[model samples]
Target: MTVNFNARPLTKALIFRIQKQNMHYSNSKYWDFCAPVAGILLTLSFAPFDYSWLALAAMAFLFAAWRGCSAKRAALRGYLFGLGAFGSGVSWVYISMHDFGGAGALESSLLTAVFAAFWALFPALAGYLSVKMKGPGQVILTPVIWMLVEYLRGYWVLNGFPWLQLAYSQLETPLAGYIPVLGAYGAGFIAALTASIAVEICRGKKRLLLITALTILWGTGALLRNQTWTHEIGQPIRVSMIQGNIAQDQKWRPENKINTLLKYKRMTEEHWDSNVIIWPETAIPAYLDQVQDAFLAPLANDAKLHNTDLIISVPVQETAPVKNFNAVITLGKEQGMYRKTHLLPFGEYLPLQPLSGFVLDLINIRLGNFTPGTATQPLLKAGGYPFITLICYEDVFGDLSVRGLPDAAFLVNVTNDGWFGDSIEPHQHMQMARMRAIETGRFLLRSTNTGMTGIVSSKGEIVGQAPLFQETALTGTINPMGGMTPYARWGDRPVIGLMVVLLLGLLGYGKVNVGRISVTAV
Candidate 1:
């Protein structure tokens, strides 16, 4: 009898099942490689590279890796991916810590690792919840959980580090049209949902349905791109954004302070013909009380003569024990002030004040102690236009940036990005500033210390920009917009509510007894 050497059907079926299982929750060593690769893809999807489509691919890979995974294995996979994403995407943190904050290399690396790991827990939580809530709707539930966690991550810990959010990558894409309607969380929801559906298509589960859904979802965004939500209330005004490019090391030195003041003065004097001339954060580099007479008074007089409004960043002294404020003060026809409300943790002040002494001993930085301004502060007036102000790190918080609302005519973001050196931080900062303009439906006038000084339209387009590390001025015209986008009116409340509803609907649909989404390995 001739024996057939081909494998039996039963054997082939078992092999196929094993392969599918491995794609979901593999005990194989290859997962270590796959997870990190997926993470790097995610990192590349943001700011510098802006390969936004890769974000969907990254999420698909991650979702596949997480499928059928025990909570523990899923957490590990998620953590590894986070390591890859933040390790590369936020490597500038190390630059800030070691290069500028006077920290040792090992210390900075360890601190950065801890920071990345902490954020990794959010994605890990999403994975755990997805598996525990597994059912026919697991794909839909996964993205909802992803968006919820992202929203929480924006404000829950240490006043939040809302950088590299998935939706931010889509700002250049048609999907960004969702921002004005549903805010960043809404764009994130669609992005995550698209990613999950892509995973389903890859598994051959719902190819036609998933493709159609994606087409409709993305096509709607393309259609909404041309929709006008806000309109110009006033004519475009000439704005001059001066980039002094002052060295971070010399900015605080008493000797170099005079030269710094003189440099900004000379630059502003040259641009006096402009309607509004602005300076970067802490441009004065001295107490407001000290500079008001010598520096500010003279500048204000010159501004009055030229019919120009001058907005400059300076530290304002308050009552005792409250600490000083990072503030922007205006001098001209329309005079007002705005203090920074969303202060950066560690950069602006230590979060856990009990350990402040111990933490300060290890790493040192300038202007590390700052008091947050009141949330209801009035918008600063520049050249008879009301402008919302965002100092340095303040623009990262989108919801907070629009506090002034319909009352504010435009946005002014003054940042001293010289600390990060010739790194990606400035570029990333500018991107967030643009998003703020989109969220509020107002033009953004950004003035930075080293570069990225420019005018951004309400539509999130860069109208004009100065070169990085250049000591020059970006001169342009931007209209003062009056109307508010839905995001400005509602903030993230609607999106957050929708996420909660979806999650509850998923749990209610399956009657699955999900006691707790814990990190337990199989």
Candidate 2:
């Protein structure tokens, strides 16, 4: 007898076995260990590593681990993931605190752990809510909750950290095309949505539909990348960004103050023939009043003679109720001043005062208590055109950058990232600064202390860059871009508002579905 053996049943049986194994693995206690690994994977997706695609896999792993689990288990898994992500991603905090902030190794480690733990709660909250709001459409609801928590962590909690956002990882990818139209958070939502769809497909739920949606989303982004959101209106101008390479420990010492000032002044002198000369944050190393007549006045005069604009950052001290502001002043052709409106918490000004003060005292860490500048200050003039000035940490806030819209010809950011030292912080900071350029549709001139000083094109590409830990001037030509991208015009309102509406609609639909199920049972 001829046996008609079919391969279809064997293939199906093998597929069933693999699916069973996957399901078992996801449900097992060992899956909780994957949470932190997923977090690390997400970190690798960001700058330095630039493994952008791993971001999707990391999110998928976390989502799969959260599925079919109890609220308590999900919270534990979420916290673990957060701990892993923040721990690995921002361990630079220890470098800043111990190496520069005068905190002991033990104290710095404890404080860093505390900082990471605090941010991790946001993710834990997201996981808890996802489980509580569990419904037939969990794939949709989970991602929404995740993005909401991300917004809270980045924008609301403790004056906003906004580091290592998923959108930053997608900068080189086609998804980056969404950045100009939708802003960083909006692009992040799309990334989260894609991750959710991927999880559903892995679970064998509407694979064709999910696959189609994925294709459309990325394909649209690829097409969008070719579109020019902003146009260049004026002639190209030569710009020089001075990277002082000042050591963090020695920067504020009274002994090094004059040397620092002279070094930057000398650097500026060399680039005076350029249309614009920029300095790193606190490059003056002294209050403006202290250096006004002796140093800056002559420098301003020289810049005017050369027909070049000098933009410098120095702390401005005001008496009568004593306050200091992180101020940027321009000299030559046009005179303007921009005080930093957004300040870095803990670094610039401590929050939750008494408690924060006590903790810092315990760790032996001292920080500045500078006053914030007014919100509606006029755009500063540089290279004969109005431009937005962001001092150090202010550039991290996207909405803050949008305030000086189509009126500003370009963007300038001055930073002192030496505090983080020979670490990933500077590179990560450069990544965020590039995003600001893309969002505004303007060339971003970023000058920094201790490297990564560069010129970012309107498309977010680094056109000119200085070596890390090197004292050098990065020279480049940038056209004054006019007009605004969609992100610059609307900011985050449209994207955030849509997310809120979608979440509420899903909740309402879930409630209705439950009601129908109850009626059928009765």
Name the top lDDT candidate: 2
Q: What lDDT is reached at residue 230 by model 2?
A: 90
Per-residue C-alpha lDDT of model 1 across residues 103-159, encoded as one tens digit per residue: 888888888887787777777787777776765588788899888878788877778
Residue pairs in candidate 1 whose N, alpha carbon or C atoms collide under 3 angstroms: none
Query: Lowest-scoring 10 consecutive residues by lDDT in candidate 1?
Result: 512-521
Judged by TM-score, which candidate is best?
2
Residue-by-residue lDDT tens digits, candidate 2, 1-522: 343344555655764676576666646877687888888888899888889998888888888888867688888888988998899999899999999999999999998999888888877898888988876678788888998888888888888988878899999998999999999998998898889999999989999999999999999999988889899888899999998898989999999988888898888888877999999898888899999999989989999999999998999999999999999999988888888888899999999989999999987889998999999999999887899999997888899888979899999999998999988888889999999998899999999988789999999999989999988999989999898899999998898888888889999997665544322221
- Per-candidate TM-scores read 0.92, 0.94
Poorest 10 consecutive residues by lDDT, candidate 2: 513-522
Off by over 4 Å in 1: 1-25, 363-367, 512-522
As for candidate 2, its clashing pairs are none
Model 1 local distance difference test score: 0.83
